[model samples]
Target: MSKTSLSLALATALAGIVSMPAAIAGTPSGAFSIFKNCPYTNPSVTTCLYNVVSSGSFVIGNTTLPITSPITLQGGLESVGPSPLYDAVGAPTLASVPAKVPGGLLGIANPAPDWPFPLWVAFWSIVNSVNDVTATIELVDTVQTNFLQALYPPAPDSGEDPVAARLTVRVHLQNPFLGGTCYIGSPQNPIRINLQTATTNPPPPNQPISGEPGNSYYVWVDEANYVGYIQDDDNSLVDNSFAVPGASGCGNVALGLPIITSVLDFLVSGAVNLKVGLPSAAGKNTAIMSGDTSLAASAYVLASEQ
Candidate 1:
């Protein structure tokens, strides 16, 4: 079959599974079952994407959290422009599902202070008991993301390797002690993570790091049709030069008492920043997402809808 015909056939098969029907929200079956979340109704959408970050580590300043839970990223890419700007308009559908920060608050670099003081000692004692605290990195804005940059391998450049999957994110710290509003970064002052699937050249204090696109192979929808390719396990997205803001609103809540809540918020925020090394410099932090990625044409997805 010709490239155009093959592309259409491949997209048709993939889209058949992804954009089956708006009425069908249940689980999808078959080889293309993984793309169940593709937004078929969106006319502007031109690409279907599903990626799972199985294992990786995010090092922020003094803390290093291993990815225990899988991080899922799924949605459609709009036919806005070219390359990375394809999703720049028409209400982009890409969504980055936040994953838990492994060990939660206990996973931080320094859970307790070295020198035991009066107020600090009391704080640490209480914090140590609150083992349910967990942190999750959430995307602050989808517009700040670059899908193409993350999807394709980087090219050799005379200049620095640009950030891949460039995203603005905030870390939500959840715990009774920290409160629901507690966050390491905010929408206004988010942590900008510039991930890349290539070698990084960060500033001082951070050494260079590398990433890979992993094994690539095309999917066969059937004997006569060829679907989009899949980036199997081993794909790595890395960045070691992103700044992290300090924690805020920690323990900030009106739990029947105003004074107690204010005090708790202050104490918790201070402790978290001090231990996690908040407001860290660009070179002091790192993020690596390793997973499998599947892609299909949006045209086919929409065609399947009809």
Candidate 2:
């Protein structure tokens, strides 16, 4: 017998089949957007997810390289997290708050019999100083898979699968400044985001490769070098190109809500792009690949004044 998870109310809601919320008057109802895959009231159709693959070439100084295996990403269905789409800066904190987040929320879930998906939070920064962009990305893979996983059940299953390696490079702005140093994590560290059903991601690479999910990475621009790069925990460089950020004194998240809107949202309001066939120090744009990661999310405007 599989152990049933979710409260009776939540399960009832799931059984009821909740439809996408309708759009507001002038707010441009987001209901019909791309995020309709994960509906709060229905779990059968919750197949929303994402993958990371190399798309094309990225040039830096005089070097370029092809994207290979070992660098990847995958989430949705089996992986989940707090992705509450907010327009504020410094939303989540990195301190004691993590203990407060719902556990086992960022990976594939069994749903019943056994919910072994432990609670975890992914904290990384996508900084693009060249283009002046930064995002304290927090992907809380809810481990909320389909009810079928639970129904069939796996013997001591972690409930997570290999989501192809993912890496998204966007040329944009920077994060909110504080006291002289800056970092990602909106509202505050250990923030809670998985408020509703969301499923959005960058397009897969034009080709194929291998990698895993539930990994960590961070990218930033070298002001001294005036270029972008991806770095792993070992301080190893991942990519030759990355997005840039708007510099310090670049303004901040909002003074206290309404009056001050975060540039993080405003800057990202633009497109996440990729380019190929650029000059490089490697004689060839070897850094160029045929894959890309869409670090995007689906959201709906519940209420609007307009």
Candidate 3:
């Protein structure tokens, strides 16, 4: 088959499971989000080198978003390795630094008010905003469009496609390990993204800003096994447009996860495979993660509407 025919065929096969007239994007069409760890070609070599790069498409009514590629124009699953988090503030000196997180992350309980998981905001494609950074308020990590494409003769698909609405969740957080100086204290910790893995603790409680409260904080012990958490303090679930972009009418747009899970794992899957999370941290969760950020630990992927 020619490249054009092969592209159409691939699009059909993928979208075939979701709706009809697969190649064309139509009412309630499907949208995709892909994360890849490509350091050689990505722009943010500092972050991209260590972090997962993201890209996807929005299947608007009747017309699939035009994919840009020299090869066939059809989205395909990614096959890349997962990257680690890092600090982006190494400018004027070096590139970036490793985040200083706490150690012994086995089965930690709710370590709230100190280090709450952040809502990872992202978009399938930039519609109104100039870039994802400005539009989503979340620091841009991986940026790409038409992120995936297929060649003629076709190939088998890899990765698992889980249910998602249109949301982004960044389980990584900023907190002081011991107390003194907070490593991820900087707003939007562009310096480093420390998780539950550090050689030493921060210091003690009550040093100043970024100090650990009660000389303690919270973190995901085993994100890979621990499902997820949607607690009361996590304000990211609420619909407050004034606070979050594209969240004006979306009241309490958040994902309900059971037993605080690791955002690292989620990002790992989203980045390595041809999958995406609904109500992306930057997108609206009017349907899925809507209402309150408070919910018992649960495992559910609110699929988007067709």
lDDT of each: 0.62, 0.23, 0.20
Worst 10 residues of 3 by lDDT: 293-302
Better of 1 and 2 by lDDT: 1
Which number leads on TM-score?
1
Task: For residues 1-306, write the lDDT of model 1, one tens digit per residue.
Answer: 333443454456555544333433343345545555666456656666667788889888787777777777666665311323233223323344445554665554233444224445444554577655666777667633344445454465746344556677888777655568988889999988777787888887999998876765556544343334343457898988888888888753543333465566666677788878887988999899898877666544333331
What is the Cα-based TM-score of model 1? 0.75
Candidate 2 lDDT by residue in tens digits, 1-306: 122322232233333323434444442123222222223222222222322333333333222222333233333232122222221112221111111111111110112212112200101111221112222233432222232221222232444422222222221123222211222222222122111111112123212222211122222222232111111121111222222222122223332323233432232221111111111122221122232322211221112112
Residue-level lDDT for 27 in candidate 3: 23
Residue-pair clashes per candidate: 3, 86, 42
TM-score of each: 0.75, 0.18, 0.16
1-112: candidate 3 lDDT, tens digit per residue = 3435423433333333343222322121122111121121222221111111122222211112211211111111122112222222222111111222222110111222
User: Least accurate stretch of 10 residues (summed lDDT) in model 2?
Assistant: 93-102
